[model samples]
Target chain A: MKKTLVILFVIIGFNAFSQTANQILLNTYNKFSKVKTFKNKVHVDFNIPSINIDTITGKSYYKAPLKFKFKFKGIAFLPKDNPFLIYNFIKDSTKYIAVLNGTEKVQKQNCIIINVIPKEEGDVMMAKFWINPNTNCPLKMQITSKSNGVILIENFYGKYANLCLPDKTIFTIDMKKFKVPKMVSADINSKSTKSKDSSTKTIGTIIFNFSNYIVNTVINDKIFTDK
Target chain B: MWQLTKIELFKIFSKPRSYIGFSAVTAIAIVIQIALYADGKSYWDFLIQSLDESFQIENLTFNGNMVCFILLQALIVQMPLLVALVSGDAISGEAAAGTIRSLLTKPVSRSKILWAKLLANEIYTFLLVLWLGILAWVVSLAIFGSGDLVVLKSDSLTIIRGADSAWRFIAAFGIAFLSLSVVVTLALLLSVFSENSIAPIIITMSVIILFTIIGTFDLPVFNQLKPFLFTTHMIIWRNLFDNPLPTEQIFVSIGVLVLHIVLFLAITFYHFKRKDITQ
Candidate 1:
């Protein structure tokens, strides 16, 4: 009779802790989910070893669910994973299991770290988010996806904190297969690429900064589809 | 010495071989431009295929600057051969014709004669490089219009602005001129050794081919030897287009080419001064 009582108590405590985790995640996701559509001027600063690219600025559009597009004048190196995909996954409680992994301070803000495991197998195998409980805004996210091995992102929020819009989101990606193409040039003395190691990967970073947010506004669907 | 150089210049231009480099450069440049005009977009698509998944690339075009850059790359390799033809025959041609004996008996010092010949060969090489520049860059601009120059390496590609390419092209051609001059000096040195003109030209080409082959491979032994080869520095002209241009490397290549020219000239002068003239 004593052992049965202890087991029952243990199950109740575990269920309570899980419910609290779900509440925290839901609260955080709700902060940013209010907007049906948003358009903002995005400035991109990219860095990758062996790649030389200039700073580019453009307009970024986001529609509810999963519709994001960058309309830039020139070329840009963007991360493979959608930045807002985690929001949709977090909002849909049935698609994933969110567990409270206790609290830790990230950049002096006390954050509640949650370990997310997707119920269904997809691009995102596992993800961890550090959300500031005070503001209900995410401070950092580390996602491991199928295509890109490991992506670490740091989010910084300023005036847009109420809307959960980040002033800047820095993404550090270690791409396993950012393949460099080889063309058959007519030059006779061109070196053979036999020496280049294909197995080795490179780390690249993209700093996405946003300002002048016009949220809950009607954005043309053509902006996403237009080439 | 100036008058003698002028006479040597006359001799060079009078030969049918002198026009070969110019005509060949013109024909090759035009052919490459035509091919690019027909189907360059596909080539670009192939090059950026790997990056397509990660990037939304826009405003990319195969413009005149790119065509010129491609022409320069293709032609630089063969420029040395064209230059070697005339330069190798400068001394040995006279010997083969039995004019070298009587010419050496003149009142002028052997050093002056060698200088005059070297000066004449340098002029011919300069003209060839100029011809290449006109056909590759100037004419290309006239045909295709101007845009960014996209330079591709074995593993990477750099996009240089259209406005910025003019200085880089000029600097590249200047370095290219210096590089070809090294070939002229080397051929002249070989010419000093052989009595027959054909031998020197063939030998100079053989050396260039051998070094280029070694540089093309990635073997341990070849890598060790690459830094010492003149051919290793020959392509450094492309460095002008590299972002954060490798200034020290460019200077080193220029210095090495200059040293080679001076050393080869000294040796040629020394050997020819004491050489026995017999037909």
Candidate 2:
């Protein structure tokens, strides 16, 4: 009887934590779901060790759900992932199980950390979020996907915090960690070799600053269709 | 001095061999442009294939700027040989044809005659580089249109905007003129010693090839010798395309090339003044 009582307490405590995580995600989702569409002017600054590109200005378009596209004036090296797709994943609680990890300080705010794993097999394998419980805004995110590997994003909200939209977003990509075809085959003697070429993996950061955001506006589906 | 140089220029143009440099440069530039036009996309795909997995590289267009850069790299290597063909034959060909004795017997001093020939050779080298500039830069722009230049080295890739590229091209051509001028003086110096036109031309080419080989490999012994090689400095023009241009390195290369021109001219003048021409 004592052992059964102990087991019952453990189940109740675990359920409480899971419910708390679920409630936090639901509030964050509700904050963002109000926007049916948005058109924003984006200014991107690329900071990569290997690449030499500086700043490029573009327009970012978003429709209901997860459609996002960027149109830059010239050649740009950028991430392929849809930036808004993370919200889509979290909003549907049936698709993923969220566990409250703990609290961590992000952008001077004590943010709640939640780890999410998809209940079904899909492109997204796992995701983690650092959410500001007070504002229901995601201050930081780590998304692991089948196509893009591990992408770490930090969102800084200002005038758009009420809508849970970031005024600035920093996307960091580690090229070597991608689960894609390798650039070159590893040399047979690479293990013992002291000399190596400089073409090895490196980190690339793309900082996107958004302004003149027109939300809940009409967006034609033509731009979202792949050419 | 200008009149003497004009006569020497006339002599250079009269020879059929002088046209070879101009013709070769034009033909090679056009051929490269044609090949690129037909299927440059595949070539670009292969070059950026490694980076594609990590980046969605938007608007890497194959345009005039890229074509011109490619042409410059290809044509610059063979330009010295073309220059050597004309400047190499300046004195030795006159000697081989028994015209040097008559040419020397003219009222001009040996120093004045040599200087005139040097001036003419310099002019020819300048025109050839200019012709390459026209075909490689101006013509390619006409054919392919304009866009940013994406230069892919062994380990790095640089994207130079179309707006910022004009000055770099002009600077590279100016440097190419300086580089080819070194070949002119070296060939003339060799000409002063040889009785036949072919020897100086052949010897100058051999030296260029030898130095190029030494500069290419980074062996410990060769590293010590690289700074002295004109071939090593000839590639300094490429630094213009780099972000945060290495101004010091460019100046050092220009200084080295100018020194080579002075040294070769001094030896050619000294040897020609005392030579027994009656033989």
Runs of candidate 1 exceeding 4 Å displacement: A1-19, A34-43, A54-67, A71-74, A117-126, A146-149, A177-199, A211-227, B1-14, B26-71, B98-120, B134-151, B155-165, B214-226, B269-279
**First chain of model 1: TM-score?**
0.88
Candidate 1: CAPRI quality band: acceptable
Clashing pairs in 2: none
Ten contiguous residues minimizing lDDT sum, candidate 1 chain A = A176-185
Q: What are the per-model DockQ values?
A: 0.25, 0.33
True contacts kept of each: 0.29, 0.34
Candidate 2 per-residue lDDT over residues A112-173, each given as its tens digit: 99999999999999999999999998999999999888899999998888998789999998
Candidate 2 per-residue lDDT over residues B1-279, each given as its tens digit: 889899999999999999999999989998999998997778777767757877788778889989999889888988999999998999999899989999898899999999999999999999999999999999989998898887656545678878889999999999999999999999999999998989999999999999987876657798799899998898888888888788998999999999999999999999999988864
Q: Identify the leading candidate in terms of TM-score.
A: 2
Alpha-carbon local distance difference test for all models: 0.85, 0.86
List, residue by residue over B73-120, the lDDT tens digit for candidate 1. Answer: 889988999999899999999999888988888899999999999999
